[model samples]
Target: MGGLTQFGQGLILAAGLASSAVNTHAETAPIEAHAVFSPQIVSGSDALRHVAYELVLDNFYDSTGVLQLTGIDIFAAPSTKPLAHIGGSGLAAALPPGVELSADNSLSIKAGGHAVILIWLALPRDIAVPRVLSHRLEFKTQTGAVQTVDGVPVRIDTTPPIIIGPPVRGGLWFADEGPGNAQSHHWGGLIADNGQLTIPQRYAIDLFGLDAKGHAVAAPIDKLAQSRLTDWAGFDSEVLAVADGVVRDFQDGVPTHDPLAPQAPTNDLTPTSLYGNYVILEIAPNIFVHYAHLNTGSVAVKIGDRVKRGEILGHLGDTGQAGAPHLHIHLSNSVNFAGSEGLPFQIDAFNLVGRGTEGEALNAESDMHLSPGKGKPVHDAMPLNGDILEF
Candidate 1:
């Protein structure tokens, strides 16, 4: 009887093992990832086509504590090889502001907390654009086990980018803080307003004029910090309409700030205070073009006025939140600056003349010289970060 009992226990254990093995539904990891918006392939000043988007990672488990992300590998759908493998410092650098990696260089998402990763993937012009992208995330669990979540897929947006003429007239304009890195305030900007998060300046460009010698100001380098608004090279440059559109909205009467004085207080600033004197034009149905930081009283058109492309809208200046004189322009779906989403648009034509960074261009010690471009005549392409172009 005892021998029969032992055999019966063995049979029961085997049956239980079979039941577990046959179970088809099993959780892979405690974390989940999805794209905030489908990435679109857009042309930059460089030879590569850039795909810029954000991924949201959620630690949905209630009892899982903290899940640390170690690596993220992005792949074209159905491919074993990854297009980009981000790990170590690369992974840490991609985290949005206020989110820092742990001492071990792993990004931590607490239980029920979420994190965002900005992916700026550049594909060679010769390579075919992928129709879909898949991601594999490697994470270290609270229990010291390493797990991977694979096959998180997001479709690629192949829609052609919006095309328009230049917002500023002929001169060498440097695209400062343009689309490129995740560290830039504009590209990395994730605004949380009214319980909703959005990036309104994702594709916006802060344009500063460069003289023949690539200097950003009319004043001498040693005198730039103390110079007035009139001393800036881009000051009083005519801001043009990019397309035939009626004025949707605008802000006026906000006086330009004193450069030597402290910056304007950032707290409790309304849209008018943030953008200063500005204009928004309805270029298309649901597509609006925004020009910000215009000089006070420089606005030429009022709301509801229909304007033609290349029409002078206003003059650029150091107004509102602008630290210095520069034209801030972007395409959006709404007239509200912080509430709208930025759309990527290209210029009809421009001569690529040089390249330099904002730091190099703004340094007051010496003239900010730019590396000479081949003077390549570009048609319908977005000027990239640090690109110096003559429109």
Candidate 2:
């Protein structure tokens, strides 16, 4: 919800039905909600299609007490059956961390304040994707008044996903903190900059490489504290362009992180610090590809340089907000990081090789115990969370 607060100023003044109250006695509902993005059905490694997006809920009640959210249900438009439902503890969990809950453990929105609900709805196999989705929210006020709101619509984006080639090659790579993981930092990341809200990392993915023995590092686990930068398997590996494009924006000369002290120093942190020594390529009109956290001075192309597919852009390294050596890549609608919305793209081809332990990275345990095997061939699909692939 970092960048979401700015929406309040204009959204409160927006002229429309944010929520429609069902109780005949009540003319309108005080709580307003709408989907932030028109989501697309993404194919995940779990064999399920996912519709991932966020809902911005603004409480306009000028009363003294908070609005307690009781339940939430989503239905495919024109259908009576609910596609998903959450209530009680589940609804509470859907709210972002640090959101205050009432005494009954329900999400409570203070009067005139707003909250964001993260949604990752997975469609069952063989189910038809709906053209649009509608939401129904149930709430109770402090005075024990129960109310219902209906018909907040979210249209589905039906355009085919963008297809591109691998950004790295000749190794076993794992999609750490990738899509399909509900707890992934990339999934819930929101940026509020220049009075605008953007979801630049919604479809982003971080890649960590593995050796022939399936280890993420060249040194033993116990020696990580004493290891060198080269000890990380992916360090200095060539990062290639995923498609033909022009270099639109980039930054370099940011110092690399020390292996013995990986956590970034708290002082002087900025958006550029989050993606040290990165490059952006405009692959198409209004569509850009971002490759971040490369080694210092390794950026090979300058702004306005045209590049071809699979061209070497830089060597991956531990820089920016990265704790360990890995490549963070994603497609976006704008060149400015944290100022644009993330766009879903597909890998043209690869071989699924293994799976890493989810929600764990940059540590001895996560690197040493990857499950290894020859997996199936994947074509034009996103490599989901913890999925291992060979390119």
Candidate 3:
């Protein structure tokens, strides 16, 4: 999802898969296939520039185990000439039943009647430009079982991403520190009680665009500001679920360290080392909402469990990838963090404090509050807190 380009022409490649048997009988077990398209660049004429994308396919199931893949097709429109095929190596393999691949090329074999087929695709350069490229994978199986899994159609954009309602309505507080103090800073995104992206930073980071550095430029902190240690833990925070979703993935129990702390001696470490306390919510088909930086032992959900929007999944604290205590939320296409692509979203309504009077809302174009300070005006703007705001 991250690699798609605006030029229309592109390539589709097969990644790999993870398989499992749902039923005791090998013949009746479901075939869960996962595929990944590693990052690649496409180069054509002067009019076209090299653009890269990463494609991931997860848990595509063939219940009857009847179909074997034949080939994959990608449909795309080019800017210049009609593009034909891509160039790159692909990966495919059989996975052990129920053991999903944690990363590309890493497979866990399990004892079960079911086998998995994994595919990886790499695109070639010199493809035509300005054409719509759609991927259609062909498969054949002995059982000819009908595929019953969800498939996301390729996206060509026109409709801007939408934020559902208001930010979660609750007491908003900032951990107090004197102005210009960097040691006690915090950061968080605003969400509605229903768990939609409503805070201005969400869109600014996800949509308004990125800077030359490729990081979310809309973040409240500049490079200098982010570098300040005191800015990390200045705000108190809590974890709120953005939508009704299943807890598909999680990690916890990692120790919190200062961002300025020295690195560990050994790179190989626990899952907690990287994620701290984290949760991945399957909000929609191939769409997952990720929450990170939770307090240790604060996770309220477990793998395979269900949660409602605005439910207390965990408490906010300094954890993985954090400078201080705050909630980091993002929508993605895959449960695996590295395999997923961020999706833009919006929240309904909330007062844009610091820009005008209280009870005002902010929109994509509105100038809203950015950082902690006093005497800021609150404006009537889009609601980002937990109140349901109608678009």
Candidate 4:
């Protein structure tokens, strides 16, 4: 695991520095360090492939210290062509402790005092095709105070990754545009082989538009099955307990943010911040399901609570880091979202509507059209809603 590797390296460095600093000060001074991975192949298709790598730095001394970053980059190349530089740069204070962070081209973080710098990259569809890609990362000290075992450099590599999962789940009712017929950005599709349906809403705002007063206003969008706009006050979006599992960890009162607004205003009310309400259910060994951007004071389950499939957990809302009101769901290997790996999953029995046709099955091997009424469903596929699914 990436966390294991990061911890091991951190431990070794801490030990090495202990002896050297013993005479200077009894109190452990924070060690400032940084790590940057060289770009490696991620996926290749049509003789061309995408590459990704990470740059991570930490201050081991202060639990909260500025995390200076450098050497952030990405490159792409064809088997028969020279490596073409895509784009990258050094990040200033890009990571903070206790937040979801990843090395595999998802998100980056930097810390400054008690605040953090978050950097997110959205991949365009042209470069997101399926293929095999490799990667490598390097570590360094900001003050030039640390070096590799051979006084050279520290780095790691991994085998190329096979991009086999669809970007989003298919089949489900979705509002394609914002209020007043606002334009919608087509994110991508979610695919499953079984008779299941997963509808991933890429634009949270598009799910429901906001009025000038920040209230959720339903748009004149097509509906799948018999689903309807749930009342905000009594809203309960039929949250299937996801899986027959126990609640391993949970936190409440995180305050929901307004999705209708662009960037979160500094003076926004705390209780209404984005990621307003959330839940994480542990369905099996090292597998947890996360649901974010729920309405505040809406969670009905708590830590260690036992729940079955199709149970009401909470209502959807505009919450943390969100552009608008929508549900954010994903499965991970660890309860700590930042330190976990994303796992592909499917939901059983939901109608596929929009763009092309109504009700069809989808899988990683299928190419779906983005036109209205063109989606499908998987008959026997299991839901990835934090449940341990079997293909």
Best by TM-score: 1
Q: For residues 242-357, what per-residue lDDT tens digits would candidate 1 score against the true structure?
A: 99999988887888875544554675424576778899999998888888889889999999999999999999877777778889887877777666777888888998887766
* Ranked by lDDT, top first: 1, 2, 3, 4
Can you tell me which runs of candidate 1 are displaced by over 4 Å?
1-27, 218-224, 264-270, 364-374
Number of clashes recorded per candidate:
0, 1, 96, 63
Q: 319-347 in candidate 2: lDDT tens per residue?
A: 78776678999888888766788888888
Q: After superposition, how far is residue 324 of candidate 3 from its true place, in Å?
A: 2.0
**Which runs in model 4 stand beyond 4 Å of their true positions?**
1-172, 175-236, 254-259, 262-274, 355-375, 379-391
Location of the lowest summed lDDT over 10 successive residues in candidate 1: 1-10
In what order do the candidates fall by TM-score, top score first? 1, 2, 4, 3
Worst 10 residues of 2 by lDDT: 4-13
Q: What's model 2's lDDT at 256?
A: 85
Give the winner by lDDT.
Answer: 1
> What are the lDDT figures for the candidates, one per model?
0.74, 0.72, 0.36, 0.34
Q: Give the winner by TM-score: 2 or 3.
A: 2
